[model samples]
Target: MIGRTRLAVDIGGTFTDLVLSLPDRTLSTKLLTTHDAPDEAVIVGTRAILAEADIDGSALDLVIHGTTLATNALIERKGARTALITTAGFRDSLEIAYEHRFEQYDLYMERPAPLVERDLRLEVPERLAADGSVLLPLDEAALRRLADVLRAQRIEALAISFLHSYINPAHEQRARDLIAAAMPELAITLSSDVCREIREYERTSTTVANAYVLPLMSRYLGRMREGLAGIGVTCPLLLMMSSGGICTVETATRFPVRLVESGPAGGVILARRVAALGGYDRALSFDMGGTTAKITLIDDFMPQQSRHFEVARAYRFAKGSGIPVRVPVIDMVEIGAGGGSIGRVDPLRRIAVGPDSAGSDPGPACYGRGGTAATVTDADVVLGRIDPSRFAGGKIALHPALAHDAVLTDVGLKLAMTTDEAARGIVEIVDENMASAARVHAVENGKDTAGRTLIAFGGAAPLHAVRLAQKLGIGRVVIPVDAGVGSAHGFLDAPIAYEVARTFLVRLDGLDQALIDALFADMRAEAEPVVRLGVPTGELAETRTAFMRYRGQGHEIAVPLDNAALQPDTLRQAFETTYTQLFGRIIPRLEIEAVTWTLGLSEPHVLPRPDQVAAPAAAAVVIDTGRMVEAATGETVDAAIFARTALRSGATLLGPAAIVESGTTTIVPSGFAARVGYGGEIIIEEKMA
Candidate 1:
């Protein structure tokens, strides 16, 4: 059967990528992201690619999209005027976040500012018991007055979180009803709806964050859909969630906070798929684009995931120094070390790279688009790693002299170094920065990074993967086909799904079977409409997980549970087994209780398994080439250059060579040799001693 025609769009900080899968082939492109409009770039690229493929946009049966607009809005503090309505005495929950400083030893450490200011955080008279019983009746008169204040203040969005509302959403739902009656135009998010788990601070933070970005996301998505429709493409539009799942545009408009890591999450999903196809059990995903780099660890062909993550960190590795958004997300470490990351000299005359980026407006100095400052991409050109004439598949030519001037003036002058030396420093430092991040992420998650194969993708990853692999002592690397537009491609393969979770504390000894059944049913009901929107005719797959731990523990671990009639004894055994795997021991004499239950509904993935086959052998030959400086030494030499498309399977190539492809280049250093795998993967291995 012919494949269905699909299109996937991923909007990054610096670029908007489009991937169109026609019945016969795949087409892709990258264009500068229109920060002001965001969808303008998508429309232009869509029209261009569709015309290039000699097809009309109306032929598309589906469209998938992922974007960083929500994440950027929160980090830049550009969200709408938002207010938080909480139980009367709990208005300070956001201010009293975590209590312990993430950087305990620092004398001047600061916490992330709350998205909603104290003045805007209003209080209403309401109380609920630990069991979700109404301790005090909700004061409707007080809520009406608060509604008036909110309207007078011109609040665009509102977040409502009442104490113990996770267990009983009655109070929160009533407040929402009252607020809607008064301000029907207001965008509101409830903690009970956004995050139905315990922990007031995290739940409130998540809800407030959702409300903060709701209006912006809703408007942007609406505009984007209209823009796409105007171009003759009329199909079901899906949004990629940070949890590596796809949902309808309606679901995305309601809970847009789940999209903070959606772009990177797509790359991880692509990596996992490639690894499974290549028969690799362990792989490290590295995605480097124009404005940021992301690294994730994949085990057993699944990307690691988490329910809690921090954003906009004030301190790079400090846990509590960033705003926490408790939503289901793939676990990864991201830093501003991409091609367009600006390089600067600190006050101490030391070289520093970003957390800031030039993005796509003017781009790098070499783009000849008016960017004056030096960036990582400019440095690569100066060092000869990038061929000026073939940058961006020859669509845009780079100016070598401009790269030299920018690096020399911005870095060489301050450090008393040559253009080559400064460029080398910038390049080496960023590689080290990415490597260091990968190491830390692995160590924190109790994972080993020593021998994992680096599955690299995106526009800039292949350019740096080799050096990064050497730094982390990795022995192999895989650069897949169409690596430049990998994330957008991954979006085409994502499952249309939604996860629903609720907090209902229950001990195993006295497990309430009836309550468990009802809870799961309700969650499934909530998720079904979202899932059916994308997979209307397919058999839905359901997954169940319970967050369990010792009663005294502050955090819980997720354990998979049978959705059918599960016995209490069997559930206890499963939880204990999982606890042992994570902690290596089970706490004796401790009562284990489940704090949160989750149910996920999605279209079942029927991906083909990789064929286990023997490795192939090859020969070394040189073709088109470029002169590049050795990263270890400043000496320039002839780096062997070979076209990735020309090399067939089982062909072996040596290091000190450049594997050239569209959108990216893999530098094979002297110590490594690449072997082509049967699955179209370029596997680089360390040469034998």
Candidate 2:
């Protein structure tokens, strides 16, 4: 069963990558993502890979997928028509946000617009005390009137979030039952079910986000299932979640908000696997696609995980300016600095690269796809960084002349510089943007990135890895085998897993062992069915967590919990131990509080152990024939181009070389040399003068 064929698909912003794994080998293919009909790209790429492998789709044991549709729908404002129902007098929570300025110095800073407009948000009379007790009874008549208004307005989806729902959930559940019974055809999302956190703004925003994407996700998954069935495939379709786990299509449709950032999560997973295999305890995973770039940190073979992320920021790098959604997400920083990001002259006459992208349909000017704007890809082509004839495994021919023309007209003419100078500026600016994001993320997590190796992947990462690494002061870089299709390949390596989170408050002064034990039991029972639906029988693993904080604090930190049943004394000791590890010292005589609890159950993972290999002795360096190329200093220098596939273990190729592969290109700047490691990972080291 372990050797059976498996299929993995990753739908990205600009391309769809498909990977087919047979018993003997693996094959991969890429196609331009069809935004108008996304399933068409999936079908075409899947069929191509299956045909290449010479196997029918029915023989596949499982099909796993990761997609950006949910994220894209929210960012582009293309989701279903949604209406919000909330507790009376709290309809303005989404608009008011936290009332703190993200940019303190700016006199005029605008907050992101709410997903649901004021007109679509209706209120009902209901109230619950903070201690899970009812204060004001729910107005059933008001709920019915809201339902009538929704029906009359033709609302496709609804979000219900009552005050204090996280504590009791009685009112929220009752409202949902009433709404569903009244309008059976409407898609509904309850705040308690989506997120049971304490913050009203975050909870309401998350529920609204879930409702907004619920209808679109349901229709898309239904179409994909039918499309696969028509092609004679009869396997269960699983979707990758932002939490770095896989769930069934049914779960995805029910909670589509979890799918946001799913595609980037796959890349982080791949980077972790590579780090473990290469025996690196810490590393940075850099993924640059056509429309965005992502950076994540990995420690001890696990990517950093967070329960908070935002979408569509009003300012590029500032936090708290975007719509916040509380979900389990692989913690990473994403920016719009991909290959197709447009370059233009700003009002200040300074050359600027983007938060705007050409995307797949119009693509970059060099793709001959009806785009006239200059982009990062166009800059690389015009600057002689990428070969005109070898992009996307030679499937697409890049027109260098068009790139030069676009740069000259749009950027160079206004800046009074040559085309090459403008191209260089664009590349440097984008690389700085990625580096700045990495630095900020590391500092926030109490990490120093200088000692970490950079693992580069995606369509655009290899093109910019050297310069980005130089900026970060990182001395080593690794380009894994099949780096271009890294995300799709990661899908084949994922484990069948599910995570469940709930809110239950407890003060440490009066610890109750029986209550805690019952909480864990209930969590396991709720998660078992969801995990079993995707995994085969008799293989599962469980992990528990507690969100702990000092009394009177508004935020909490996640602490790991032991699975063994414990007495009150033992639980108190464990809480102190975790608190000390996080904050250096426990607060003196301050009582600890447990805000919420989470339980995650997963299928047993079959991860490969790192193979022990003898260290290789230094060997004589080999130099391929060199070519003369223009350098950044406006001087011609001798550079070597080597075929990455032909480089053997311990082979050292020196400075100013281009390691060209079918899927990606790596440029080795002056004063650096690359060595092939044992696992086919290319490691670049700076040569001492």
Candidate 3:
């Protein structure tokens, strides 16, 4: 059985969100992120939320944390001093990634520099054939000689990767032993341990990434645990993984690279849960916080999942432009379009929002912090989309004059327009930017987003969801309860789970059933301990998947298999069914090969079910507020405002209106109307002309 008192914290690039839930009620808060110590924000937010709930930290039964620290550390190159140990002649595999340029036409394209410099990428004289046969034994003397060199370099963490290590990790394990004996204090990450997959470059890069952030994550998690304990909270601290599952802190510390997408994963979870509650079959999740906006596609109440994802891409959405981390992740497209996204006039005198953010240290000009930069928040303030006095539940009073000045100086002056017009341009551009991204992502996944309901959450999503939906040609939007801290709330709904994936190349006809069984058993052995640590006493469920593709294909599509005894015919039929659905037709007469296998262990979640969920009614209230400028028409109109809590399940309110809450506000444009659902969720739909 789950505990009654639990807490969830999600630390993003700009804000730290916290939710403290008790039997009777739930309390949540959002604070600007403290970059110096992400845990500091969590502790402070936790304390504040508990105080509001009138409960001591010690009363909490569990603590769940999800953070973007790993992602930030990689993008900023702020991880510990690291080095790489690889097989001889393959030291440049990570550097010589993919061989060709990701942006081929650009002659001046610059590659993402490898984390480890050339000097630090030490090579051990060893060779292994494709079949994992030891061709040249590892030279112990030579490896020991490099010990002095590594010690002098003062490397805090080391990554060891060897050719054919996926098939046989003997050489990699030996190298790790030698290094540990020499530098016992070093944080070592082995490729076979982190990601035992094919693709030498990706494997090495994933290992290097794990090692790079190992020390930092270890320290941060330690401090978080201690900090909570000091504050009278003595509960197990679980972490949200990128795969939308909760894990023990030990598991997260071992593979912090998996936490790169942890924060966004929570948002996806929230969308999926809320989608299921509202009975939305096809929905798009738009999570817009202060630093970034994440778009995830959900079908039949399940968010899309992928085994591999890229991070820190130079070309924002370019697939191969970032470092690839082979970990279970919720598939989504993210963009630097958020409330704190900086807005500026480019050289061509065109207004542009980010790919870069102001964050919290110096937030938007309207935040009244040290920030003077014009940001999307400032534009929203200038356009009257955000109420100055009610921003952040009135925790931070906004200054409209400063916002107006920032917008006028940054955009209006550059383009010879008024502050309002410039703000309009910024909002329009950002909305279109998100819509374009959604369209691109949908096309890539063979999905059409036109008919999907937009489940908008996070601090900024509700403020922009209706407009974004309009831009996407979507007619409906849902903003769940406590939308501001949606991700943190999502953590409470997650289950104790872990996934283990490894490369085990085999053809269906030549597949060794015993080997496959052993492989899955080994994977279960690795994941069960982690899941058991989190769940302690629960029935754990196991799911198996094989990544299969036609012969000669570069990548494979995931095909689920029966957890019972596997056979060649069953595997082939499953692969063909999924392949046909994906491509409309399977390649005939081609041999099929399985490249990787993944085993997931999870405790069953007692999912919530909403009752009396229904569509928006055709009735609405005509409560009018002061005149506000119409987003599309440039002319001021009498916009209505409604208190969200005062409305019941069947109550409807038409736009142009602002549905106000303490921490979040949903803007329904004149072309739309909103109705309250049985789950207390606000559903907005377009109005017929």
lDDT of candidate 1 over 405-514, digit per residue (tens): 99999999999999999999998889999999999889777677888889999888988898898899888899887888889988988888899989988888889888
Model 2 TM-score?
A: 0.94
What are the models' TM-scores? 0.95, 0.94, 0.97
* Tens digit per residue, CA lDDT, model 2, 387-475: 77767778888888999999898899999999888888888889998999899888877676898989999988988897888889888
Error of 3 at 609 (Å): 3.8
Query: Residue 470 error for model 2, in Å?
Result: 1.9
Tens-digit per-residue lDDT, 125-207, candidate 3: 99988889999999998899888988999899999999999989999899889978988999999999999888898899999
Off by over 4 Å in 2: 1-3, 565-587, 614-635, 648-650
Deviation in Å, model 1, residue 624 alpha carbon: 1.9
Give the candidate number with the greatest TM-score: 3
Off by over 4 Å in 1: 347-349, 562-569, 613-623, 633-635
- What residue pairs are clashing in model 1? none
Predict model 1's lDDT versus the native.
0.88
Error of 2 at 684 (Å): 1.8
Candidate-wise lDDT, in order: 0.88, 0.84, 0.87
Note the residue pairs that clash in candidate 3.
Answer: none
